[model samples]
Target: MALDKKTIRLLILEDSQNEAERLVSLFRNAGRATRVHRVTSAEDLEASLGQIWDLLITAPSSAALDPTQAVSAIRRHAKDIPVIRLIEGNDSDAITEALALGAQDAVPQGEDERLVLIADRELANLEERRARRAAEVALREAEKRCQLLLDSSVDAIAYVHDGMHIYANRTYLELFGYDDVEELEGMPMIDLIASCDQVNFKEFLKNYQHQEGSAELVCGGVRADGGNFKARMHFSPAAYDGEPCIQVVIRTESDSAGLEEKLREISSQDLVTGLYNRNRFLEMLEPAVERAVNAGQEASLAYIRIDRFAGLQAELGLADADLLLSDLAQLLRARFGAQQPLARFADDVFTALLPGSPTAGAEGELRALLKQAEAHLFDIGGRTVQLTLSIGLAGLDEKTARAQDVIDRAHRCADEAGDGNALKRYDPADELAAAANRGSVVAMVRQALERNGFRLLFQPIISLRGDTYEHYEVLLRLLNPQGEEVPPTEFLAAAKEAGLAAKIDRWVLLNSIKLLAEHRTKGHNTRLFIHLSSASVQDPGLLPWLSVALKAARLPSDSLVLQLSEPDAIAYLKQAKVLAQGLEELHCKLAISQFGCALNPFSTLKHLNAGFVKVDGSYTQDLGRPENQEALKTLLASLHSQAILTIVPFVESASVLATLWQAGVNYIQGHYLQGPSQSMDYDFSPDE
Candidate 1:
């Protein structure tokens, strides 16, 4: 490396024969690279001074050497190069006088170290100045390139700092209804921001300073025209001619205009009908709820899934069905307008976000709208596609509830509406099913919990090799006020639909635990089978509850086998595996009910670790047929290979039981051995 990092050449002039020799030696020995010319006499000094040198070094006695005159003479030849003085002693006064002559610096004679030090220092200072200049040039060129790209960008671009619009590109100027970019310069970005969102935008600006990576961010924005959209902004600290500056990038909403047009083609929208697509309609509901709450507006989301859209689709085919949907969407849109955001929620379903519309208003509008929607017809593919809407409305109090909660409520209402002549409102019905449920059905379940309206009946699961049974499957039952028995099929489905499945499933497990404990205390070696739902498996709480319940019931885990329906078995496979593993730890057996019943194979069986599989009754009903018997035998062979015992369910007759046994089924369940009965109070034994 060059010890002297000077950007320009330098030369020193001195006049003393000794002092001039000293100056010459000092300049030569200087850590920096410099040229020195020494003159001994005043005439030689004057002669040398007459020549150009970056700085003049002469004997102090050269009185004719006017420091200013010497400097001015040197400048005449080298007008840009600055000069410095060399003093014979450490005379602050003399050095000050030389500096006043416009020389950049001065150093004393005999202080060779100090002179050399100043030379090195000046050289470094010169290099730094040059470097800064180079940097400035490069930045200017780069800035020009960046400006070209920013101006040409299709999206609008602008830089807003401290609320003021410091800069904007041509595109941004056009977006703001301006003819030139400078038009918006110096204008507060706050002026363009929507009044309602000004405060929010201000708060978000504070975030840019703390951000580490790029400071680029996205936010919802408003155009000068008051149109709303989203934009992504990029930012960085910069400088303009030494003035602090902020650089920015802005993109307009028009870029999405194409996608919006294409998406509208399938249009989550109906043409003849102005209804929204099922997916798009759902998307609209969330924001509607937010708007209702934030704006203190009343709103309701109605999911009017047409009752038999499939039947409608089948009758009309694509062309006419599409036309019908378009017509329906349009009709609903017309009826609701600003009051609701209307769309086709489904093939047959038309939905709307009813605003400022209370339940009573929504109910009446929906009822009247349903009549109009049903009346609307379309012709295509040579047929008229006709349909009626099933409207299920969920009242949304955006203030405290979530979008999903409102949706779930709407679906539940739709479910209860059945065949569609009626409209159901949410916010009621299953309330009583909860701890605070007040609905009639919920009240019924609550009564069962309190008045012993709950009961258990064991369905037989007999070993094929044994003349009697292996164990009895315990099923739960609830009695209504009429003393009518409600089977698991009835209430279980209802419980799940009502979102009370977990509540009922838990109750069954707890009660069964008590029964098993009581039976064990009686010296019974009965194997108790309990059925659980996929819903219960997801209750992370259920696993721990089972743990405590089993210990409290004082029943060996293996003595209690859990039977899961095929659908439930498949749906909760992972949790089922965990549950099975926990049970297996206690040597417990796992069984699947109504097995081989899924249209889709319950492939999860490979991982369930279950030990028993029961065939649905539909299979047993046809056992006399060779194909049926062969199917049964094939299933049994497969299950036997996996060590999964095969059991036949609903064995209505001895022939069915015999066929199942002959087919290699290892167990039998149903009336053939013993009908389902509350008599499960008796201990189950293989020899029963």
Candidate 2:
């Protein structure tokens, strides 16, 4: 036999010296990575326990010397290190038992790879487990930090889903007149939603949550005893207690607007440059367009797209990238005064609006910066990097007409054309199609309103039991100038996206009210309803304008019902709630235009004292389908039980009308009765 080394730290736990010396040879010849120690007896094991053993062996004669206990104690001291138990072929059972008991592996009288594989795999598993534990601990710490921040935030915060309150801040409790968070924990925020908004509050929240991860949900709420006020709310879903859930924060509208202005945090502020954020800047665009047109002043927008940004990101991690952006924002702020609004549009992109500044001068300055920036090196993590830019320009010429339009054109030019910091102006012919579209849309709308180019139709809403015409719904028609009629379904979306919904709503409301008031004065006992859009609700100026207009028309508030779309209102809930409240204070009867959009919490029904719920057309329009009819029946029954009037819209035929009547509909409106009219003089004569 071959002995590898003259001497080593070998005191094998064996009863025989011959077998112990043979096993010791393996360690002496073991690879440079190994440092092993061994003991040969139970007493020897105890004595060697004080020694740091990287590897241990059981000699053949020590089979009965409590090999299990000896190996177990060795494992406690060197959990990561391997132990090779020497075994004979006839002792497989004892070897298996010893290996299971804590010995890393059993190597037969000869050398084998199995022992090495076992040792390597076990060591790797131990390391992975340690890493996972560390990661889990870090995640826990992060979650705790987020929770602490949320709890102490000034905004009233909460989480609501499926009409259930899952989380809340103390500020939320105080806002709603609750004494403790515990009291409000399981209560729906809608429970305190003002009486005038109860009918659609849940619908609004559902809609708002679906708008951009989170939107500012503004609405009116009643204090514990019922005093009403407006609130600005934010709700976004985040993981809580390992479950995906919503997190909400609310600031009263007055306090929110005031606080925002004081903090100079307008909706979305470019945090780095401290300028109006992209969202607010976009909002300011339309006004800027109008201002330019009114003042006959020229304006241009330079959509600056960062080139080679991803390369920079790859070269410098996020922290260094952020620092680089901060530096760039500082340069922009210094170059463009605070009055010239600027924003960090995206991670690497920035935009600046130039007013009264010549396009050529702006071009010259940007060109100079581009040259400097291209050659300028960023030192990050001992690495140097450079960035380039691409610019697309749009001016207040025939090419780009509105703020969003200008932004899109500029972005298209920058993105589609060029390499580093190349400057290009918008091409009129390039955007002629879009311009033509705008002109066509505006002309179509003007024609609809001017030539009485639209139709006005009414659907009589009969009492459920009485089956008498108690009210009528005023519908719209978009038509060409030649009296060729256009369907509302065809143009409502275009009207909305084109930002003409509010004007259209105003026109419809004033006309509907005038007609309804006429019938009321003639002792006809008629009430007419018209729909309002979310855009109109967003405009706080609308309510007072409506009040003044209606008063001027001498229309009694109750005689003219105002219809509001559930989905639209829900998206702009806070605004919707406030607008509804204003209408209620004016004694205007309000109805949800599309109810049962989603499963709204019944708790939301406590506000709005809503007189009517227009069953969503999907549920009522196709009573021909059993599912549609059944859904309508269930909805009508549920609504009627709450003493809420149910109106079925889009009744195209008498058969559909009769089915709705049997299903307990409180009113009916649609094409089979009358198409929309162009003027308030539309007469819903029984004979017609």
Candidate 3:
């Protein structure tokens, strides 16, 4: 009797096609949908091995090929595929020799049931190997991404294990007067603190680990040159290199004239405009520049000059001009907000500092704001007065090492922009040329959302254990103005920063459910896996909206499995818990994808009702290695103990399938089965 039914490809090496057909008939009778290709000569056998096949069977005493030579060829070219040798007359010595020559198992002629059973076992082994290699690739990619984020952090951050520094960002090295990470290697955490606070700091560390949350301390910091400065350090329990560590963030307090000037301006406020005075804006600019430089971020400075301020004042009089200026200031505040520093620099000039990486969208938005101001007619003292603005935008980059340099550059650009053009951007490298590139990518994203310019792609999630339900993961793609397809990785971050991620998520959710409804009408029990963003986790409206959409589509909740990345779930734990609980109430399943990379991934699951956990693909990319195999087995064992179904993704080759089966993975997915397609056309029926 057949133990399982699966579609498997087979390669046979035999002189007689009849004999190869008989061997293939055994697998077919055992309930496997077998795709068999017979190769009699050595050349044909080599060609057959080059293609995809699940198992290889060789016939001994053939006229065209030697069984030993065939095994040798398979071992050299396609070693991952299991090879079986068929001997005649129950020759024990021949079976022993074949087994020693790397054949997985040797069986006598006939006895079709035993042959089928051996093939089934070998196929399972092949599946496990393929799963493990996929995992290793995912892990390396995750590590690379983590390193990039750590390097780009704005604060001086470090990870300390056993009271010694294990890892530090670029900002941390610069703050402690170290040129390279090697200089701080094995350095004690206490050494960074001033001698005066050493005793108190030691006491704090002793009790730090036992505390529930993060702890902050204000202490004097000692630099490598022995200089001391006031510093505030925050300590939290984190993990580094697969071990527990303390994450530290240090911020040094400035004691320069700029700081004192900023303090003086904080007490006095501009009554009319509700903005900072000139000194305050310039003071904040210095710190913004420092952060942008150290963190590899860009700080944008905008210099706005009222076009022909003297003429406006003369025509409208002092009282009217003052009202107009105050009204304009109110408008600017309404538009830019007070997140960064906004200040009235002079009688008619205003300035604002934009912190973070400068995007093309910021420049385009500023210009658009300028255009709006030009188009608006102000009602001042019962009379209509029109005003225009000459705006200059300067972004912090390698050339502008000093904060004051960028400020001067913006002023020069504004001065050069005259009244005709009225807008200019300081781009020494011509990198932000408006004519060369379209307006902001964020603007493009908004337009796409408004026009419904998004498309969906589906990738099959095959069942390793012969589950009947058809599964596919839904992926999103955006079409740009040029009709070019923009991948999610390229535009998804921009959408999130622009606060449009929730809208995108809803679009995918509704569309996927609608498609699922249509797919079910075809008599196929199909399920779609959809991804959610961090913004979706916090959106209170999403769950209710999803309930309505599902009801309208007449689709069951279980047909859709909403998933979020593991890092995102950890970042927004409270919101994730709510989403998970709400999904449970809705009778929907939650999948935490890209899992097992956190400090303690299981800790995350303890708070949520995630029924499926997709193991991070990095663990399986190199499953042939013994270490990865052991790690995957351990994770699977832990997950299975909790009765949670494990999904091993990125299964690219047959080599890792056997290892995955051994590790007890319930499901598998990757490009090896199929890349994403417009239709869910994967052959789910094993009988096919």
Q: How far is candidate 2 from the true structure (C-alpha RMSD, Å)?
A: 37.9
lDDT of 2 by residue, 610-674 (tens): 77888777786557898878877987898889898888877778788667778878776676765
On TM-score, the stronger of 1 and 3 is: 3
Model 2 quality (TM-score): 0.36
Q: What does the lDDT read for residue 14 in candidate 1?
A: 46
Please give, for residues 315-408, the per-residue lDDT of candidate 3 as tens digits: 9888888899899988788878557678898888898887763634468878877878988889998888888899888876422445667787
Model 3, which residues run further than 4 Å from truth?
1-439
TM-score of 3: 0.40
lDDT of 2 at 360: 45
Lowest lDDT 10-residue stretch of candidate 3: 428-437
Candidate 1 matches the true fold with a TM-score of: 0.37
Separately for all candidates shown, the number of backbone clashes (residues 3 or more apart, or on different chains) is 22, 25, 39
The C-alpha TM-scores of every prediction are: 0.37, 0.36, 0.40
Which ranges in model 2 have alpha carbons more than 4 Å from their true place? 1-439, 446-455, 467-470, 481-490, 515-523, 601-604, 621-628, 656-658, 677-688
Leading candidate by TM-score: 3
Candidate 2: worst 10 consecutive residues by lDDT?
A: 1-10
lDDT of each: 0.64, 0.65, 0.79
What's the lDDT for residue 294 in model 2? 41
